[model samples]
Target: MSHGYPKEGFNLVGSWDDWKSFVPLSRSGQSGSFVARVPIRRPPGLEEFQILQGQDWAARYYPTARGEGVEGPGNAHGRNFRVTPLPSDCMQLEILWDVLGRKVTWKFLNAAEQEIQAGEKKVAAKKGAKARSAPRNQASNRGPFFLVGSWDNWKGFAEFLPFGDSFRTKVKVGLDMKRVEFQVVVARDWNRRFHPTSSGDGLAGPDVGHGLNWRAEVGGKKWLEVTWSPDRAPYVEWTFPDPADAHEAAAEDFAAMLRDLAKEGSGAWFRGMAGIFEALPKCQRSSPYGAKAENEATARCLLATFLRDLETMADPRGPAPGGQRGALKELEEQCEQLLKDTVGEIDYATAGGDFMQEALPVDPATGPVQLKLWHRLVYLPLVMYVRNTVHLYEMLERLKAQSSGAGRGRLRALLDAKGTARESPYSWLVFSIVGALQILYHARAAAEKRGGCDAFPLELLASSPPQTVWIQDGVEWSPSHGSGAGAFQRKQVVNCEPMKPLGTLRKGDGLMYRGIWLPADADEDTIRYQYSFQSFSRSIEGVMRVLRFYSGVASTKAGEAARAGHILMYIGVKFQGWRLAMASWQ
Candidate 1:
């Protein structure tokens, strides 16, 4: 078993020497010590050992350190010296020690210049000057060999590992095996050219005799994602530090752009939100998870709607630059703020102290059928989606900023054309269609180059809270009495719950945050109900009764100002509609 060991179980044509041979005499078989060694000698010309002994290779294994979260002892290492066998079959080994057994091992191609020198005992003579002489090359990616799994579309595998740079996951302790580990490799660029394979690809390998686990520390605390494995895969995909930090970074970018918009006085931001509202009902849809898709859809639609309105006000109608645009600008700023707060919440969840593992929900009908497929098909994709939106919004804001000073008159022609032309609501359909075409276009090239399709736009799905709503619950109604008039389309489940906006409540602001959930065989007259706060009075948190209003939570009698207030009270006897809906949901 050389440095480039092919997981456990596969036999190497080496000396009968077990781990004890290379281990220091005083530290052999002992766990959690710098001096102790686990021996798996690499035989020259042996393919298995050859991989580990590439140019230079050395490794150390230790039990999962205490408070290393759920996973167990892991190993990290790098190449030091190339060890070559002598006439008596004695192999020369080069060992470079590092912190907490995290280091690189070297097995150079050179034979023992003299007799095989024995490794000196460092742990035994605690605090020895020579032992302390080892320099801490913190830059080395080598560590006790651990594995982690990540669902990478490019690699088609979560735990794919390559030689030069390695995110090769180390195993976790006290648990079964999984795969995928991200340890520091000697070369930073090694990750790009590695041999990547996905779980569905049937890329099976070894199970560690012990678990492998480590935490990427930040600000003195492990991340909120406590990744662990329960099987031989030895892989768990985790964003070290925190997933929120990443999200906030994206949000900050988006918010900064909004500030630019505020300064530019571009009505585009406001009109975009107005467009979102206008387009929402038309494209309202649901997923099988019971998520109405309304909330996320509303966000999109409102955003688009507001943009349209702002542009309209800027040109075709109202004053060129007055209170009209100002009001819309304020709304635009609010949306930006909403998005920012969402990122903050995202950070909060990942940082929450939840030790239990969660079963990621998946659409069995159209999901990846492999280990942690939900992540590739869903989680990471959503992260990318949120991030992309942030980027796009920023771009939009910046563009508006640059165009602001031109005066509404310059953009008048463009605005007039839009007002009269066919306005297509921005929806995932366009993105999906385009993405599919791109996938097809890349298929041939990908096949030839062995690279996965990187241009697929499968990010239409939002990675919001996995909410569940069903046809039994009935959909919300619009101001007009009508079924099928949902925030999104119907005929499936919806995933979402009452999103309690963490501030004071307002009339017509938004119903208890729930998405749409349509049932199969649903069509033009099917009704779906949702619960809402019955503001009998303006007191927030008032003991609102449950009610089950019909589809299209809209009433013509409660038109105009009602759109801003009494969104729930006018639907039906407040507290009454919710009761019926809750019973059905139950």
Candidate 2:
């Protein structure tokens, strides 16, 4: 038999597990004709069957009275086609189906091709079928579909209103429910359920089982829109554009924002850091390195506590804390030993000038003086702190830059009010120290090239052996070795370009030397100790400004002298009267 639409296929569904155990009819070489042969059996009598278009029950051929050639209010009650009982002797039967104009007809024949019975039925015209049959841009006649899920215990379906080529529904999900899962069903039938694939496109399959349910957060006021092409084979999309109950003001929102930023080349490290920040209690959200004064004060107290903890770990006189020692505890012990032994009895005032002028001594016999264990202990935590802090700062700056109007106002307020440094002291210190280390390492490397010591500081000092780290769509480099040496090594960790500072000979655009990421924009002082010294100077100035602000010192020369006095006392440096003249008051 032939159909009006030749490309459309039909399935044979009947009373015996009709939905599950169905047969597909084969199209005849003659245009739209379709044919299928069946072998009759006893026990469960085969009395009724429906010719469904592909897997869609909504587009089935409903059997009608002989001459009623159209589907409407007249033939709305037509059920599945009934079959006449076959003779006891007969076993095989062949069926033929065809549609002509508005009428559909089917007939059964014996093996000899003799017609046993014949029936003629009218095809149901879709609602407003005439308009639908017009030009491509005309209004469509496809009826609405329904949604079914755990909401109604899967017993009944909910209707979706048509809008252009899509269908939409406003579902009332319980406010207390964590999530809602459902699927689109056509014609309230089990055989025509649209289950989503991994890619979110809908496909007709068996019962829409658990885990196969299209899931969405239910505690929010959400609008679900499903788009489909009427003339095409089954392809459907379900999207939720806005969720009214989204927790934008919560920590999870910031975490999600960080995750998104990490999708860009330079942001992968933010993923793990974001988790740590998200887990922090709201009261502890502020970092000492933060921009706002109040948060910074809280951070300072926290830092003091952290330092005290370190001192306890360092003191051989005291027992270490119980439980498995973490990275911080291990580091504290290393720093404690280094402080007590390696640089013992040295005054910062006397040593500061030498450390600043002589770049640590490297013996010609050994490559470079192995960095003290304290450097390793201090390095990792400082790296983590600097990375997390800088990431937070960059995120806020980008948000403030991108937002406008009321959004911009709110972000601007957050930018100004948050305890994040506009020029991060923690980041500056981290950069400066790491830069100084890099310079010392490279100097030793250069000297080794000229028949000097072959030892490298980073290689000797790094906690883990050098390994290449990869960034998605970005350059790669080793963290424990200087740039050119490990550019081709295979082992990789993070997924972002290694930091490459401006005016450097490095091939990449980011740095992760010695397990610490250095900002690409900061100037590195490889020759004249200008950048590191300037960074240290600025940091001291920042501390002085903070002291003056807290002390309520009015802008004056005496107030400046007091702030200078605080710094000179802390660093154990002599206050040269002429140098004090150069200090700027806030």
Candidate 3:
């Protein structure tokens, strides 16, 4: 609902506050509506509150005369709006303000579970049926049922306590959990597991048919109730917090991660980037066209901006007085040197060697042959690339003690060669870089600005030939890219082209590549950098190709047979391997 007529905002003053220290409501991203989720910490009972404009009792909101039992003059001193308690931890307070008459209207809603049930009711009504509740029957399990899911890394078996005709267990979810998938197993047996019958909610029955994993949106919930009995549907009662609150919770968790990293050993790198990290997750916004493309472009530019900024901050010649070396100068130099050593002096023209030369024949008339840096980068052994990257991170940690600006803020390397500790598929370098870029991108979006120049504040660094640099469309040659010398200036990248959908599938598809003009401000002509943006696009295209293959060659019955045959063949291979291994042991 609304706030102070047309002036600033308003707060919800109630019995909980003793009519003092009013709770302010935030704008709900709507025109004239404001909302707040007021926590009910005490006993559930009648809650009395009134809309107080700017925390002033002189301009309080009361029940409208149109409301039943609302009597007398609906003025500042009128009766307070009343609400009976419902089964909820918090109450949703919505206020609508009308500037014309300085009128105020509000309503209370049971926040979490009730909101979900209300939606369920609407869905059931549309299907011309009444909403159904989980059936309760007294039945004993053959053995103890164990809970296994993401909450416990799918390894530990948390046994359920016996309940009336069913086994029930309390799942305490982590604060960072966005979604959770789980299953109940009897006697800790994987084969005797329960799954969702249809692909929606969970069902428990004899393992005779295929089923999907039982899943639910945790949405920042701290606890869940999972109940199941034999020959019945398994039920998981999930407590989903308010969506806005959930978003805030997730953002706080991500910020905590960044703060922890800052405290570890790369303090200089994260020095003035705290505010940016805190605002990154909130940068997501809905657009007319889906947000996927927007997210991708933002992600790409963000990565570019982060790498550029890191290079600038770690430059040997710092912007600080006396031309002092940067705090990360040593780390930067070591990493750059390591990269150069690993890849060697890359000559893009001759990097591809015989294979690339034969693939793309160059005419003698066309001066210098153009080549893609991407090809060279990808062609290099992935193991070598990752190994070198890991080495760079290790060097950063080792040199942190001698580094200046701030210490104990080093980003940890995720790729641990010694498998003593757990590690993620993505390395810590990727995480740190991605986090920094997100901050810059969101900060730029909030400022309502476009273009790489505005999005990234750091002066574009200078790059010599034989070094790889990404250039987007709409680039124009300028005297200098940044303030420094030997820098080639070019027009800033504002927008990226939307990703196109894969057309009709073919038996085989090659790399769909394109050529880009590499800016050379000094010379009138610029060499083209050939690359493929469709590398990632091929994954989805491959899936579509398989689907089209089946659709073209087989009928529904035959398609099902083919799928079954594939599964049987896969199982047979596994069995054969097991037999061979056993024979080898003998």
Candidate 4:
């Protein structure tokens, strides 16, 4: 039927047994005209049948004015067109429905013309039919089924290749055809066939009505492979592994792990714990010694609460025992309370002493021993707290990336709020703990130094070497003296070269001028500079080699001076605004 509604199409419906279902009319080759040829069988003594314009009774058509041979008065609800049984066995009735005018017209063709059209249809069907061969692997007792579709010109069925657990076939669809429709039939038996859903797209379940065909739109590529899996419901899927299905499966597995952890501790709990560790940033897990006791406990509690809420909210049975909105809020309240309780229990005075005794059993009778014990206790947990906070930050970031939908809105919001590197509560906690530990370490070190025994040598506290070092070329003269007035005074001409700008540096490397330490500006540089005096033996030997070349100094005396750790002082020369300096041994 032609419809003025323009947006939606309508189907034909009637009271006859054969017309109970909707039959769509063709609009091809006609302007605003919907045409259909309905074949009706009249049983003996059958008087009349009713025909309507739409699938629903509400949309049924009614006559606006009475016409010749038309029966019945129309009403607001609906009106049925009257049908008269012809004397022949069956008749082909042609109908034209105009939706805009709310009118329908129909007429029966002469018996002679109907017979001629029926004969022509049969001839065309015979010409289009072609016998298709069965697959080589087909069972002898069972006949072969084949795939038939518009893509193949409706000529005949094509055989499918037998493969492990499935049947497959490749077909080429024409680029010009915007869409193609097809079905699978068993040994030319239409009744035993696979059809698409009513919309002629997607795989149809067994519960779907019959006679519909599957359809696919043409892609840029011409070649397509189709597969059928008897074991799988709907029996068909396109392309390769479905990305939506894969993503859904991963989400399900994550949810299942959370559920297991919430319900009880078992193998599933261990697996879930592994997932927590896996979610941590790689850098956090790199340390040989793992997390501190208190931080680890906090992390476990946070994870447990977070997972419990996620599982409860996502439960299929609906949020009941644990309401969606309250679950996370309750957990957050509990965590805040726990933080308060734990912080109250910290006794700073006894905490440091207790930690020192627990970390190291050695008696702090000596200054050095007390200092050693304090350093261990303070540094160990400081490292661990930093790592745990980092792990927690990374876990939150991962959850934020994966979260979606209204159900997870609160969680996403919380993650976004706490995701900052600078003001996050976890970061603040780590910073406060580390600062406290450093204060404790320094206080204990100062106390030990006040005692009679030497705590640690201050002379050992020299800056580390610069990463990149260069040897000097030009020789400069310098005066050197040590241990006595005017003793072994000499004018030393040492090699010098301009220092290169700093880049990436490694251990055992430094900037040098005439084989001596050249300190880069310490005020502006973040990297500590190492003095050559720290490696006394090597520095003296290097200077001695230069002295031997310039002066006739005895090898024995130079070796003695190197072993004694006494080196001649070098002076700086302002060359091209760069600090060029060197050391010499007397």
**Top TM-score hit:** 3
Q: Model 4, stretches more than 4 Å misplaced?
A: 1-3, 44-54, 68-78, 85-89, 100-103, 107-586
Worst 10 residues of 3 by lDDT: 122-131
Q: Which lDDT tens digits does candidate 1 get at residues 1-586?
A: 4342323311111121211112221212324212211122222322111112112223323223442321212222321122333222222332333323444233322121223333311111111111112212111111112233231211211222211121222112212223333321111122212111232222111222112222332333322232222122323334433324434443454344334434532133324323433543222211011111123333332232222223334442332334334433433343334434432222213323211121122222334222222221222222323322222222221222111121232222221112211122222222222233333334334333553332221111111222212221265322122224223212323323222222212223323322223333222222322111112222223213112111212211111222332222222222213421211121
N/CA/C clash count, model 4: 4
lDDT of 3 at 254: 38
TM-score of each: 0.19, 0.19, 0.25, 0.18
Clashing pairs in 4: 463-530, 464-530, 467-505, 476-494
Off by over 4 Å in 2: 1-144, 198-210, 222-586
Candidate 2: worst-modelled 10 consecutive residues by lDDT: 526-535
Ordered by lDDT, highest first, the candidates read 2, 3, 4, 1
Candidate 3 structure, TM-score to reference: 0.25
The deviation in Å at residue 455 for candidate 2 is 99
User: How many collisions per candidate?
Assistant: 138, 20, 18, 4
The residue-by-residue lDDT of candidate 4 on 1-586, one tens digit each, is 2235433454555433333345456563555667555444333312223334344544445543353333222233434455554423223455676544445666554322233222221100101111121122221111133567787676655544332234444455665788876666544445445555454334432222355766666665454446654332225444322224434543564444344333442233223333333333322222111111123323333332223323333344432222323433333343334434433223334322233223222212211123222222233333333333444333332332221210222222222222221112232222233444444445436535675223322211122111121112222211110012221212222213211222211122433333322222112111122211112222445555554422221111222234344344443333124464544343
lDDT of each: 0.25, 0.36, 0.36, 0.35
Give the lowest summed-lDDT range of ten residues in model 1. Answer: 123-132
